[model samples]
Structures are given as structure tokens and as C-alpha cells.
Target: MKALYFTADKMMELRDIAVPVPKKGQYLIQVKVCGICGSDFEGYMGKTGRRTPPMIMGHEFAGVITEAPEGGKFKKGESVVVFPKPFCGTCEYCKKGLVNVCTSGICMGVLSADGAMCEYVAIDEKYLIPFSPEKLPYDIASMTEPLSVAYRAVYKISDEELQASDHIVVIGAGTIGLLVTAMLSYRKAKHIIVSDTQEFRLETAKKMGAHTVVNPASGDFEEAIKKATDGKKCDFAIEAVGISATAESSLDALKIGGTAIWIGNAQKIVSINMQKIVTTELSVRGSYVYDFDGFKKCVELLQNKVIDVSSMITDTYKLQDGVAAFKALENNTDGKMLKVMLEV
Candidate 1:
């Protein structure tokens, strides 16, 4: 089997590896597609500590079942998508059905474990969701993890609040950001404002249903956002850029008594207006990766055509070309490239 691994110096390298067999409660999948995520690039650059050296690097993958143990729900030749999150079911958080925050949770690819970057992977049956390529293509199915993350963020929003048709701002027009905009559009938001420095990504956001797009790099975005909204301010803001500036922008755009959901990982501590939160009653929430239900719903949406995950994939690469693929992602060379897949 061929696998793309993170070397000691934090670069992706293709190498021949041993094929894994299914354990008692696991299934062996013949990997069809694996999408490269922003975190994957960060891990490649040594910014994310979750991915150690000498490990396969991929988590969002879909494929056909090559082997299934006795009594498992999946059988050989069945197509499926993996959750990628390997968590202990015995932790306090897991006991409360919040397994994503389990104390000993380990995400495949990002952790020191063999991931879907290879020709085959032995995954636990509990985290696999069977699907057909007829509903969604293999490359789109590879995006189930990140789509699930965006879905979980929206799932956390209150139902009553969703019905309020409040103005919403999504920072960053990347994969998760675009998906968040689509979800908000489906939720019937009064206005969906997407902000990013890249005009191409902003245009992609418009195609995905953003009512307003702003280039934060052009000028003071807060005033533009305010002017665009007629001084009403966004009722809900989401930070998808995973940086200090975007994180603070999410806070600055929110209306008094509104909610700001930070889905991005802040590499450094970001200053915030805590006084405004105290005076205006603002709510801040941190969203993690998906749980079982979130992944299921993401697949359902993809299957039902409620959202188009396929269009988000703009490029593909073979395992041998992993280095160039990651480099293209880093440089943002292609216009509006949302997701890149590695063909194993």
C-alpha cells in the first residue's frame, strides 16, 4: 500500500507501507478519496501539534469496504464515509454524548496513527456511515469531516434563534465558511454576509448564497459591514478564518445581545472587548468537530442535494503528488480552490 506521511521535518512524503487488516470491531476500507484540509496544511507546517512525524496524513475520506469482521454492520463492497475521530467511550464527556471532547480522543491522520492516506485503512465500525456514490461522488464524500464540523456549528444554534431570521456574518469564504453560509441560507437568515480578503472566494460565497461579500483587507470592514446592514449589525457571527483578526472581527460585527461563534482555532491569544459583552449581553461559544449525529446529517444533506459539497472540491492529486498539492494549497495558486483530494 502507498501512503502519504508527515516526515520529521513536517513535509509530506509518499512511501510504500504495509496494508492493515480489520480488527474484531473494525472494517478495512479501500480508500477511494481523501481531501486535504486547512488543518492538514497547518500540521504539515508544524503549526498543529496533533500530527506527529512518521504518520499517515488524512482524515476526511470515503471508500469501499474491503473487509468487515463478523457481526459488523458493514460488509465487503459496501461504500461508506468515516468519522475519523477515535474517542474513548468511557470518558465523562463521552458519557454525556459529547464524545468529540473525550479526554483521550484521537483523530486519525492528525494523530500518531495510520490514516486514510493509504490504499487501505482499518477503521472502527462505530464511526463508519454507509453511503452510495450515486448520491454523492467519492471526492465530495471525502469532505464529510469538515462539512460535519460546519454542520455541528450550525446545529448548536438555538432553534428559536434560527427562526428569528437574524442577520449573519461568516468570516472567511473557505470550505467551512461557505458551508456555514449555505446552512444559514437554508435556515432562512434575513441576510448572509461573508467576509474574506480573496475576491475569488467571496464570489464563490455568492454562488453558495451569500447576500453580501466584503474584502476585509480593503479597509475598515466593520464600517462597511455596518453600512451594508444599515447600522443594524449582524445578529450572529461565525469565525471560520482561524486567526486573531477574523476572531476579533466576528466579535466586532455582532449586534448587542447577539451571539458570536468561534469555530476557528486561534494560534495566539486574541484581545476582545469584554466590557461590551458585559454591557450588551453578548454570548461567545467555541465549536468543536462533529459528533455521530452531525456526520450523519452532513451525509444526508449531501445525499438529498440540500447542499452541494461536490462543487467545493477544486483540485485532486495522486499520493505521489502530495507535496505539490499541499504547496498549491499553501500558495492559494488556483482561484477559489476550496478542497483538494489525494487519490490513493
Candidate 2:
């Protein structure tokens, strides 16, 4: 089997490797497709230190079950999406259903895990998500990770304020931001405002159902929010850029009692206004990856065509062109590229 390996010097190389056998209670999945994530691009640029070199770094993926574990729930040759993380189910967070933040959790395709960049991976049968291949292609199913991440972001919103009557703001017009915008649009949110410095990404946000997009590089995003909302403030805000400035922008866009959720982790620190938060009675929270329940719901949403992901796949590259795929995603400075998939 062939696998793409990231080197210590930040280069990608295709190497021939022996196939991995499934461990106890695991299935051997023949990887069909894998998506290059923003984090993956970050790792390529040597920004995020999560993925060390000499690693197979691909988590967003789908595959066909080539060998099933003994007494597995699903059979061989079943088309499935792979959930990237494995949590210690006995932990407190896991018991409370917050698997994303479970302290002992470790994800595949990063650090010590080999990930799905190869032709085959040993996956726990419980993490396999089944969907009809006739209706959903390997390309779209491979996107379940990002879609699930978007779902988890929306899930972090205060339940009372996520309805159609509430105006919301999404800071960052990238993939996760656009997906969040789509979710809000599908749920009939009263208004959706997206902010970014890049105009092209803002344009994509508009097509994804953002009622308005603001280029903060030109002016204040708070003012843009006021204009777009007709002087009304947003009830909820999602910060997806993972920077201090955008997180602050999310806080500044919210109503007096509104909530803000941070999904991006770009910087180690950001300046915050404690006085404003206290006086305004604002609720600021951090949301990690999806829990199992939310992941399942998002998969069903995709399987049923509830969230249209057809437009998210901007480009696809063959596994042999894995290095090219990384370059394409990294050099997408105009923000024209959304999701790039590897046809394994």
C-alpha cells in the first residue's frame, strides 16, 4: 500500500508500506477518500505543532470495510465515514457525553496516530458511520468530519437563541464558517452575518446563506453588524477564525445578554474586556470537536440531504498527487479553495 508521509523538513513524500492488520475489536478499512483540513494546511506550513513530521496526517475521510472485527455490528464491504477521535469512555467528560473534551482523548492522523492518508487503516468498529454509497459518494461522505465540526459549533449556541427568530453572526468566512452559515440558513435563522478580510471568502459566505458579509480590514465589524442588522444586535455569535481579534469581534457583535462560542484556536492568547463582559452579562464559551451524538446527527443530516455539502468540495487530487493537494490547499491565498480531497 502507498501512504503520504510528512517529513521533518515540511515536505510530503509517497512511500510504499505494508498494510496494517486490524486489531482486536477493529475493522480494516480500505480508505477511499480523505479531505485536507485547515489544520492539515496549518501543519504543512509548520504552524500547528499537533502533527509532528513523519506522520500520515488525514482525519476527514471515508472508506469501505475490507475486514470486519469478530462480531462487529457492520459487515464487510460497507461504506462508512470514519470518526477521527477515540475517547476514553470511562472518563468523566465521556460519561457526561462531552467526548470532544474528554481529557484522555487522542485523535488519529496527528501526533502518534498514523491517520487515514494511507490505502488502509485499522478503525474501531464503533466509530464507523454507515451510509448508502448509492446516494452518497465517497467524496461527500469524507466531509462528515468538517460537517460534524460545524454541527458541534452550532450545538454550542445557547439553545434558546438558535431559532429562526434570532439574528446570528459568524466570524470567519472559511470552511467551518461557511458550514455554520449553511446550518443557520437551513434552520431559517432571521439573519446571518459573516466577517472576513478576504472578499472572495465573504462572497462564498453570501452564497451559503449569509445575509451580509463584512470586510473588517476596511472598517469596524461592529459597525458593519449594526448596518446589516438594521441597528439590531445579534443574539448569538460563532468565532471560527481561531484568533484573538475575531474572538473579540464575536463578543462585540452580540446583544447585551447574547452568547458567543469560540471554535478556532489560532493564537495562544487574546485580549478580553472583562468589564464589558460583566456589565453586558455576556456568555462566552469554547467548543471543541463533536461529541458522538452530534456526529451521528450530522451524518444523518448529510445522508438525508439536509445540509447541502456539494459546493464545499472545491478540488480533488489523486493519492499519488498528495503533495500537490497540500500545495493547492496551502497556496489558496484568495480563499477560493474550500475543501480539497485526496482520492485514495
Candidate 3:
């Protein structure tokens, strides 16, 4: 077996390693496609402390099962998408169905756990969701993890609030931001406003059903949001960029008592307008990764063509070209790259 290892900051190496053997209740999956996430990029750059060095770094992957426990719920030759986060069922958070935040859980590819940036991975049955490759390609199926993040972020707001709101804004046109826009489109949001510094991403947001796309690099972002909403601002704002400017802009683009869902966590801390939030009664909520049900829902949504993400995959590289893949994302100054996939 071969594996791509994140050896250090801005460094990756492909090395030959022994294949993993499946445990008693685990399934051995031969990875087909894996997508590099924003967090992975941060790890590559040594920006986030979540991922350490000398580990396989990939969680959004899809593969075919080659070995499984006898008479298990899934069998050999089954195509599956990994949930990536394996949680202890006995944990308090897991008992409450908040498995995403289970204290005893470990997210594959983050920290010390070796993930699927390799030829194979042995995943427990509880973390695998079987899917048909005919309905969803391996590359697209690998996006289930990020799509689930988008789903949970959009659905964080209640149905009543989402329907009652006339204006909604999504800050940042990255993968999560674009998917959030698509989910808003699926929910039939009245006016979808997407903001980003990159014009290419703004254009892509338009293609993803954004009613108004604003480039902060062009003009004032808050003014653009106000103009787009006819001076009412937005009823809801989803911040997908975890920087200080974008996080503040999400609050600035909202009307009184508007809700802001913080989905991106690139920055561990960002300054915000506390007085404005207090005076306007604004609500800011942090949305983390998705639970099992959310992941399953995203899988179904992708398989059913409810959310078309084929365009989101901007580039693909062979597993052996892992370093080039990371460099491509690192040097994506024009913002043309959206999601980069590695074919194993």
C-alpha cells in the first residue's frame, strides 16, 4: 500500500506502507477518491493546530470495500463513504445525538489518526455509509463530508425562520460557502446574497443560484449587501470565512436581530463588534461538523441530484502527485480552484 504523509509544514511525501488489516467489526476499504479540505490546507500551511505532522491527512473520501466481517451489515465490493468521525456511543454527547461533538470521538485525518490519503483504510461499520457509484461518482461521493457541514449550517436556523426571512447572505465563496448557497437555493430562499473577494468564486456562486453576488474587493461589502437587500440588510448571514474581516462583515450585513451562523474556523479567534451585536440583539452561532444523520442526508441528496456539485470539483490529481495537489491549492491566487480531489 502507498500513503501520502503530511511530514511537516508545507511538506508532503508519498511512501510505501503495509496495508491495514480490518479488525473484528471493521471493513477494509480501498480508497478511490479523496478531497482536500480547507482545514487540510491550513494544516499544510501550519496555520491550524488541529492537525499534527507525520500523519495521513484526508477525511472526505469514498472507496470500495475489499474486506468485511462475515455476515456484517455491509459486505465486500460495496461502495461506501466514510463519516470520518468515529464517536463513542456511550458518551454524553453521543447519547444526546450530538455525535459531532462527542467528547470521546476522534476525527480521522486530524490530530494523530491516520486518514484515507492512502490506498486503503480500515473503518468501523458504524462510520461507513453504503452508496452506489453509478448514482454518485467516487469524486462526488467524496464530497459527502463537506456537504454535510453545509447542510448542518443551513439547517441550524429553524424552518420557520428560514422561510420567514426575505434576505440571506453567505460570506465567502469557498467550498462550504458555495454549498451553503446551494442549500439555500434548494430551500427556495427568497434572496440569496453571496460575498467574496474573488470574482471567480462570486461568479460560481451565481451559477449555484445566488441572486446577488458581491465582490468585497470591488466595493464596500456592507454597502453591497444593503443595496442588494434594498437597504433592509439581510435577515440571516452565514459566515464561511473565519477571518476577522469576513466574520465582522457577516454581522455588519445583518439587520436587527438577524442570525449569523459561523461555519468556518480557520482563525481560532477573531475580533467582532460586541456593542453592535448587543445593541441590535444579533445572534451568532457556531456550527461544527455534522452528525451521522446529517451525513446520511447529504449522501442521499448528492445521490438524488438534489444538489449538483459536479462543478465544484475544479481539479483532480493522482495520489502520487499529492505534493503537487497541495501546491496547486496553495498557489490558487486567482481562486479558480474550488475542490481538489486525489484519485488513489
Candidate 4:
């Protein structure tokens, strides 16, 4: 077996390694396609401490089962998408169905756990979700993880609040942001506003169904939002950039008492205006990864063609060209690249 290892800062190496043997209840999957995430880029740059060196770094992946326990629910040769985060079913959060934030949950590829950026990986059977290859291609199926994240973020707001929101702002037109915008559009959001520093991303956002796009680097972002909303500001804002400035922009773009959902996790700590939030009665909610049911729903959405993800995937590369793939994402100054996939 071959694996792409994150050896050091801004470095990746394809090395030969022994295939992993399936654990007690794990299934051996032959990885087909894996998507390079923004967090992988951050780990490559040594920004986020979540990823350590000499570990395979990929979570968004789809594959075919090569080995499975005898008489298991899922048999060998089945196509499946992995849910990266394995939770302890006995945990309090897991018992409450909040598996995304399970107290004893650990995300694969984030730390010591090697991920699916290789020829094969042994994953627990509980984390595998079957998908039809005829309906969902491997490249698109690999996006289930991120799409689930987007779904959870948008659905964090209640159905009443989402339907009543006449104006919604999405900060940062990254993968998650663009996907969030697409989900909102699919739900027929009245007006969708997306902001980013890159015009290319803003253009892509428009293609994803954003009614208004603002480049915060060009001029005043709030002014653009006010103009887009007719000076009423936004009824809801979703922050997907996890930076201090963008996080603050999400809060500032909302009208009094509006809700803001923070989905990005790049930064561990971000400063915001507590006074404004307290005085204006604004609500700030943090949305993590999707629960198990949410992940299954995203797979269903993809299988049924309810949400089109064709536009979100911008580039693909061979698994051996992992270094070039990471480089393309790192040097994406023009922001033409959105989601980069590695074909194993």
C-alpha cells in the first residue's frame, strides 16, 4: 500500500506502507477519492496544531469495501462514504444524539489517527455510509463530509427562523461557505449575500446562487450589506472563515436580535464585540460537524440530486501528485480552486 504523509511544514511525501488490518469490528476500505480540505492546507502550513507531522491527512473520502466481518450488515465490494469522526456510543453527548460533539469522540486525520489519503484504510463499521456509485460518483461522494458540515450549519437555525429570514449573509466564500450558500439556495432563501476577499470566490458564490457578493478587501463590507438589504442589515449571518475579522463581520452584518452561526474552526480563539451582542440581543451559536443522521441525510441529498455539488469541486489530482495538489491549494491566490480531490 502507498500513503501520503504530512512529514513536515508545507511538505507531503508519498511513501510505501503496509496495508492496515481490520480491527475487531472494522472494515477495510479501498480508498478511491479523497478531498483535500482547508484544514489540511492549514496543517500543511503548520498553522493549526491539530495535525501533527508523519500522519496521513484526509477525512473527506469515499471508497469500496475490500474486507468486512463475516455476515456483517455491509458486505465486501460495497461502496461507502466514511464519517471520519468515530464517537463512543456510551458518552453523554452520544447518548443525546449529539455525536458530532461527543465527549469521547476523535476525528480521524486530525491528530495521531491516520486518514484515508492512501490505497486502503480500516474504518469502524459504524462510521461507514453506503452510497450508490451509479447515482453518486466517487469524486462527489467524497464531498459528503463537507456537505454534511454545511447542512448542519444552515439547519442550526430553526425552520421558522430560516423561513422568516428575508436577508442572510455568509462570511468567507471558502468550501464550507460556498456549500452553505448552495444549501441555502436549495431551500429557496429569499436573498443570499456572500463576502470574501477574493473576487474569484465571489464569482463562484454567484454561481452557487448568491444574490449579492461582496469583496471585503475592495471596500466597506457592512455598507455593501446595508445596500443589499436596503439598510435593514441581514436577518441571519453565517461565519465560515473562523478568523477574528470575519467572525466579527458576521455579527456586525446582522440586524438587532439576528442570529449568527459560527461554523469555521480554523482559529481557536477569536475576539468579538460583547457589548454589541449584549446590547442588541444578538445570538451567536457554534455549529460543529454533522450528527450521524445529518451525515446520512447529506448522502441521501447527493444521491437524489437535491443539491448540486458539481460546481464546488474545482480540481482533481492523482494520489501520487499529492504534493502538487497541496501546492495548488496553497498558492490559490486567484481563488479559482475550491475543492481539490485526490484520486487514489
* Best-fitting candidate, scored by lDDT: 3
Q: What is the C-alpha lDDT of each candidate?
A: 0.83, 0.85, 0.93, 0.92
Q: Lowest-scoring 10 consecutive residues by lDDT in candidate 1?
A: 329-338
Query: TM-scores for all candidates?
Result: 0.95, 0.95, 0.99, 0.98
Tens-digit lDDT string for candidate 2 (236-302): 8899988778888988998888788888876667887878789999988888878898888888888
Residue pair clashes in candidate 2: 242-264
> For residues 1-344, could you state the per-residue lDDT of candidate 1 as single tens digits?
88888886547788887888666788889999998877777778777576788888888899999888888887999999998887888888888888888878778887587677879988888888988898788887877788888888877778788778458899988888988888887777778999998888888898888999999889999998898789989888988867777877888898888898888873646777778789989898889888887888888888788887666778888877887887777687544667889987
Which parts of model 3 have CA positions greater than 4 angstroms off? Answer: none
Worst 10 residues of 2 by lDDT: 157-166
Which residue pairs collide, candidate 4? none
lDDT of 4 by residue, 1-344 (tens): 98999999999999999999888888999999999989988988998888988899999999999999987889999999999998998878899999988877778888777888999999888899999999999999998999999999999877788788899999999999999999999888899999999888899899889999988888888888899899999999999989899999998899999999999898999999999999999998999989999999999999998988898898999999998999878788888888999999
lDDT of 2: 0.85
Error of 1 at 288 (Å): 0.3
- 98-190: candidate 3 lDDT, tens digit per residue: 999988878899988889999999988999899999989999999999999999999998889988999999999999999999999999999
In model 1, the runs with Cα more than 4 Å from the true position are 266-268, 333-335
